[model samples]
Target: MDSFKHMHEWRQNIDRFFGESFWNEFDSILKPNIPQINIYRKDYEILCVINIPGIQQIKQIRCEIDGYHLRLQGEIELPAKGYELIQEEIIQGSFNRAIELPYRCREDKVHARYEHGLVFVKLYKDVHDSNKSKTISIEEGEQ
Candidate 1:
């Protein structure tokens, strides 16, 4: 029938408008999230496992803690040089990622290690005195 032929043509036109090349261009424009991380909470400490490949040295990564947040900054470099890139799926660039912790961590008790292209960070929780109270002094001020 003519109606079925027209429907097929419409579908083909729509598919040609948004084809594989369009999606490939879109993927190139949007960068994927690099250095994926996983966090685990234990009784007294938090463990963070981060995937950071293509790092040549441990000094390429830096970790910092602020309040209840952990910040990781690093650069990933490809081990091979002087080679043409035919296809690229792994991302290689400088990245900064921040992770929110469940509780405040002690700055002095934190430790991190890099092995087998993965960084393991251990953060010890800070003990707080919940029952401690402070007396407030009231002062009169102008309106």
Candidate 2:
């Protein structure tokens, strides 16, 4: 009987230390990675396929290209109103994902489309003279 009392006290201590919000934090950490992406590079274009479920409209996602990087920002929402949640494994929230490209992409030639819970982004490579040099201006700091 004494050992049972000690075990109960230990469980209470652990519960107090973890609190009620611990599962929320744990769920965020343990949930699957959102907006999983796959990139493919061809000779002059790059194709990026992203998995983003629960998007209601295409306007909910924003895609951008910066130099050799592709940025995706969006929110995924699941309609769960007036219903009890027995279990929650799907992640639904705002996400911002940045992916590095193998080469610089042209900003003006970028194309993006969303379909069937997936986002497809196609970017054209920026073909420029890499050997060209430009002058840099330097400003003196406190010496």
Candidate 3:
């Protein structure tokens, strides 16, 4: 029968290529690739915005604050050869994002910036000391 129909179509193409690479690495580890944030509150100050995209310089981005959390580390560089990544929901390498400061901020008056690719933080709302918490100072911003 023609070599058993070419071994059943090569075992159905090796089970559809390992079932699409095991659901694309189980949906990128249950979904979590960082980059994509937006905190509100304006006036007393408490804004944040992140959306880094394949950063190449700018010290690979890095910020930190402690009074309710506000950390962000970066690294999204991947594409050194003839591209071909069909569909990848942004997220290339090392990334760590954190934001949680409804109040209690003023780690030395935080303020960051990083145009275009986005990353404009600005916290300063101790509002008469809401149980202060320190750990700041991460400059380098503007344009």
Candidate 4:
């Protein structure tokens, strides 16, 4: 009876080893990259916070928002280059990430600020009244 119990538990463990969660964990360890980001949404606006370390200059980062998509591009420059790399968990080099926001944002009202090692972005949501209707005049194309 004890032998049968052991076999059952072993089979369960083997099944778990081949599960999606197990593979995801293994994949992250093998290729640990990309900056971590958190986003919050409200009726009027959306807020995004990005975690970036070892940033030398704020000018190195660039952010743009078009429609519902936001793109981030930056690099983390190593302070000392001569020393042999022993262990590195922090990802360096130029990284770009594009995220689609839940709501359509007003590009003209987008604001961004970088402080310490985190970037804060505030995007205002576009306001459109469903009951209102308007007509647009067609424009002739330039020759």
Of candidates 2 and 1, the better by TM-score? 1
Candidate 4 steric clashes? 0
Each candidate structure's TM-score, on Cα atoms with residue i matched to residue i, is 0.64, 0.63, 0.29, 0.63
All candidates in order of lDDT, best leading: 1, 3, 2, 4
Q: Give the 10-residue window scoring lowest on summed lDDT in candidate 2.
A: 134-143
List candidate 1 segments past 4 Å from native. Answer: 1-29, 129-143
| Candidate 1 lDDT tens digits, 1-143 | 69999998886786698863655555436876667789999999999888888776666787777657788888878877889988987778899877888988777666677777777887888785232222111112221
lDDT of 3 by residue, 4-35 (tens): 99998886787698764654666547777587
Report the candidate with higher TM-score, 2 versus 3: 2
For candidate 2, what is the total of clashing residue pairs?
Answer: 0
Top-TM-score candidate index: 1
RMSD of each: 14.9, 13.3, 12.1, 11.9
Across residues 94-142, which tens digit of lDDT does each residue of candidate 4 receive?
Answer: 8887778897777666667666677788888777423221211112122
